[model samples]
Target: MPKVRIVDIEDRRFRVFSSPTVPGGREFVLVHGIGISHRLFSRLHRVLSAKHTVHTLDLPGFGGMPRPDSDPDIADMARDLAEVLERLGIGPVVAVGDSMGTQWVVELGAQRPDLVTHVVAIGPVADARHRTLFAQAAALGLDSLREPPSANARVLVEYARCGPRWYGRQVRHMIDYPLEQRAAELVPPLLVMRGGRDPIAGPEWSRAVARCAPRSRFVEVPGQPHLVQHTAPRPVAEAIEWFLAEVPQ
Candidate 1:
C-alpha cells in the first residue's frame, strides 16, 4: 500500500499518495487532470512504482479535498505544487501530468526548473485551435465514446466528488492557460504524449506542443483514448521509460 498524507499549503490542502522509493531509481510525481484526482493514476502509479518512487497528488478542490476560500489560477496552483514538493524534500523529479494537469506541470517546470528534471504531458488539453469551453466539452464527450467503461466510470465518480462549482471555477483557468507557451519556456526536457484516438489532444496539437519545447519528444499510444494511462498503463510506462532513456538527462 502507498503511504497517504494530507498536506496543507497556506489555505489550500492537498492529498498525496506515495510509494516506496527504489534504490537507484528516479522519482516521479503524477498530477491528474481537471475535475479528477490521483485515483485516476492508480494503475500508472502501480507500474511506475515497481522501479521508481511515485507520488500522486489530489490537488485542492478535487478528489474530495477541501477547496480554497478563493479561486486559484494556474500559476497559483503551480506555486502550491512547488511548495508541496519542497516540503516533501522531493525535487528535480520527472513530473507527469494529464490533461489540464499538463498545464500545471508546464508552469511548474517553467517557474521552478530546479524542482523538475523532466516533464511528461499525457493527453494534454486546451488545444489552441479549440480553447473555448464548448469546444473542450464537445471534445471530451467524443473522447468518452472512445474510452473504456472502466475509465469513464472512474472519471464520472471523480467529477462528482469534484462538484460542478469547483470544476467550473478551475476550467476557466485551464482554458485560459497558455500551456504551449509555458512548455516552450521550460528548462527541463519535455515529453508530450497522447492516446492515438484522443479527440481532445489531436495529433497536430500534440506535435505542436512537442515542437514548442527546445528538448522534447512526442509519443502516441495506438488506439487509446484520453484516459490512456488508466486503460493502458504498461504502454504508457514503456513510453515514459523510452523517453527518459533517449532524452539527455
Candidate 2:
C-alpha cells in the first residue's frame, strides 16, 4: 500500500498517496480531475509504481480533503500542487493528469517549469469548440454511460464525497480554463491522450491540444471512454512509457 500523508497549505489541505521509490527510477505525479480524488488513479498508480516512484494527489475541496473557505481557480490549484511537490522534495517529475486535472498540470508546468519535466494530459477537457457548462455536462453525462461499471461506481462514490455544492463551484473553473493557450506556453514536453471513444475530449480537440505545444505527441486508446486511465491502466501506462521514451529526458 502507498503511504498516505496530509499536507496543509494555509486554510486548505491535500492528501498525497506515495509509493515507495525505486532507486534510479524517474518520479511520476498523478493528479485527478474535478469532483474526484486520488482513488481514480489507483490502477495507474499500481502500474507505474512497478517501475518508478508514483505520487497521487487529492487536491483541496475534493477526495475528502477539507474545502477552502472559497473556491480556487485552476492556477490556484496548480500553485497548491507545486507547493506539495516542493514540500515533499520531489520535482522534475513527469506530471500526469486526467480531465480537468490536465489544466492543473499544464498550469503547473507553465508556472514552475523547473518542477515538471513532462506533462501528460489524459482525456483533457474544455474542448475549444464546447467550452460551455451545458456542453461539458452533456459530455460528462455521455461519458458516464460509456464508462465501465467499476469506473462509474468509483466516480459516483467520489462525487458523493465531493458533494454537489463543491462540484458546482469547481466546474466553472474547469470550463473556463484556457488549456490550449497554457499548453502552448508550457516549457515541458506535452503528451495529449484521449480514449478513441471519449466524448469530452474528442479526437479533434485532443489533437488541437497537442498541436498547441511545441513539443507534444497525441495518442488515442481505442474502445475506451473518458476515464480511460482508470478503466485501461496497462494500455495508458504503455502509452506513457512510449511518450517518455520518445521525449528527451
Encode model 2's per-residue lDDT on 1-249: one tens digit a residue: 788888998888988899998998889999999988988899999999999999999988888888788678999989988999999888789999999999999999999999999999999998876788888888889999999998899898989988988888999998888898999998999999999899999898899999999899999999999999988999999999999999874
Assess the local accuracy of residue 195 in candidate 2 as a C-alpha lDDT between 0 and 100: 93
Assess each prediction's global lDDT (C-alpha) against the native.
0.92, 0.92
**In model 2, which range of ten residues has the least summed lDDT?**
128-137
Per-residue CA lDDT of model 1 for 1-249, tens digit only, reads 898988898889998899997899999999999998898899999999999999999999999899788898999999999999988888678999999999999999999999999999998878876699889899999989998888889899999988988999999999888888888898999999999999999999999999999999999999999988998999999999999999966
Q: Which regions of candidate 1 fall more than 4 Å away from where they truly are?
A: none
94, model 2: CA deviation in Å?
0.4
Clashes of 2: 0
